[model samples]
Target: MASENMEISLPLELHPFVIRVLDDPDLQQRLASIVEAKAFVEESLKVAAEQEIPLNAEILASTLRPDPLGLGRFTSAPLQMDNWPPIGWLPTRTVQSQDGTPAFDWVWFGPHRHSRPFFEEDVRRAEAMPFNWLFRVRTGLQALISGYGSEPEVPLKGLIFHMSRCGSTLLSQMYASVPDSLVSSEPEPLGGVIQWIRLAKVDQESAITVMRAIVAALGRDSGTGAKYHLIKAEAWNAHSIALFRNAFPSVNWVFLYRNSIEVLVSLLRQPAIHTVENLMPREMVELNDEEPRSREEFAALVVAKIGKSIITHQHLGGGLVIAYPDIIDAATTSIP
Candidate 1:
């Protein structure tokens, strides 16, 4: 066994050929050697386990934790070739992951995890699952999907998209009441993927891959006999209707809207970040920002654009439309 602090020396002249080895045919040979090395390493681990050495406990008990402060990948020199793609859920941001990669970072949230109800408890718990501190595990996305060896959780019971201030939360709460249903309301990572896809100009195929991995990761059965999984998306996510529909075409969805006046008034009383003037893309809204409207007008205009996007999706037969007043009836009758 190698000593804990034993320093291993390497040939200084190997630097020039390092890139050649990384980018050439010998890479296959190098990969094969790594596989052999890992087998020996695993054998050592097995021996250690047989001896009851508790070798991993120190690292496991400390850094890697459930409800980690964030998730990220290792991306610096002194490259850890032995642990390529060293991604994990971490209890702190002390170690930064590769920035601008097709990856995600998560922070713990409490309110989202509320437990019981029409779907209130279920949605709250599932949405908050990302924030829960539990034993941590890390795997590359492709490896994760390959290990599953099957298609992702599909035909999710339904999706709920809304114009803010509508009864979206109430609807999700009701769904939580259903027996064995898991409701994920406004999950941030899912929302982030949409933004990343657009702002990062990520290709559609890669975006789909990332989206599938995220939903699959979060879509695990809640171990409470959950038979249905419902996702309530963020309000502005209505704009990404095409991408979302393409990803989950079979999933039934509802778009909830309310009176523009009511939405504007609600925003005025309790402002949200999105209600600020010019907060959204100018190309998307063509707003007259030079002579901005009052906060209420700006809020109303944002709501109108969201409603218009939802309506377009509905008109194209991607989802059903329900006015705020009709949500309860629609929920009781249409949703199983």
Candidate 2:
């Protein structure tokens, strides 16, 4: 089969220091190999597109859209994994810390010979990439479709929106304990789907595809006689309610809020999480010189955004507001 033309452009200019390092022949060769692998992956996707194969939600969410940074450069050629390391190049993994403590793992695959922990900047870049957004949309769509048609013994009650560290996870776990209920915690598909929604040129078909996939997956997971599928997404995805409502108008929504100060304090203390980049204004950063203060302000702004989003959707009906304290108490009682 003839290969389709595939191109991915990087969002940021390469740092001068990094550019100089690429002068080395060895590094250049390794980088070329990585590019080749990306091309091979893209080719395979082209074939799938040509064949009109339905993509699973997980794959759709991660790969279809053009990355903002143009890093969606997977190869269409077959990969020769025989010589690669057994662990191979999987997306970042969570691993134990050097001190034997539990820590979030941040791994990457590239031409660079040495492996080091990714910093906040690296994560921000990854999140901005178009491919990452595409992957999320594809995956969420697949999951939704899988869950939709199955017999729903239990009607889906509603969805909950929250800020991170606001006890949302705890709340979701609690709701899962209801008889015949299913709960999906911080599923990756939502993130991918939302990324596509944020693009200037939105594709309604793609959005519908994703929403259907998530709903279907939820239904299937809940089983034939099960009740609701409570989906708890990452705090950053609070805006997803808009997309969800667009696709499934009748689905109810519940937005959760907490004390801004407390939420900020909790997020800053965590390692391996990305700090704000393009989202925050320069003035906001300048006012809060300290990292903690900056993080607090950022969290406050994000929470405000989430609140506004809820309000915007409230008029449509079936939206509720839940306090963090109430949610925590509810979770404690609900979870077995």
TM-score, model 1 to reference? 0.62
- Residue 267, model 2: lDDT of 63
Name the TM-score of candidate 2: 0.48
* lDDT of candidate 1 over 150-229, digit per residue (tens): 43342266888888888998998898777666677776556655666676777877777666666654554323456677
Estimate, for each residue in 72-110, the C-alpha lDDT of model 2 and write its tens digit: 223221111111111112222122224432111112222
Model 1, total clashes: 17
Best TM-score goes to which candidate?
Answer: 1
Among all windows of 10 consecutive residues in model 2, the one with the lowest summed lDDT is: 79-88
**Reference-based lDDT, residue 310, model 2:** 67
Error (Å) of candidate 1 at residue 49 is 13
Best by lDDT: 1
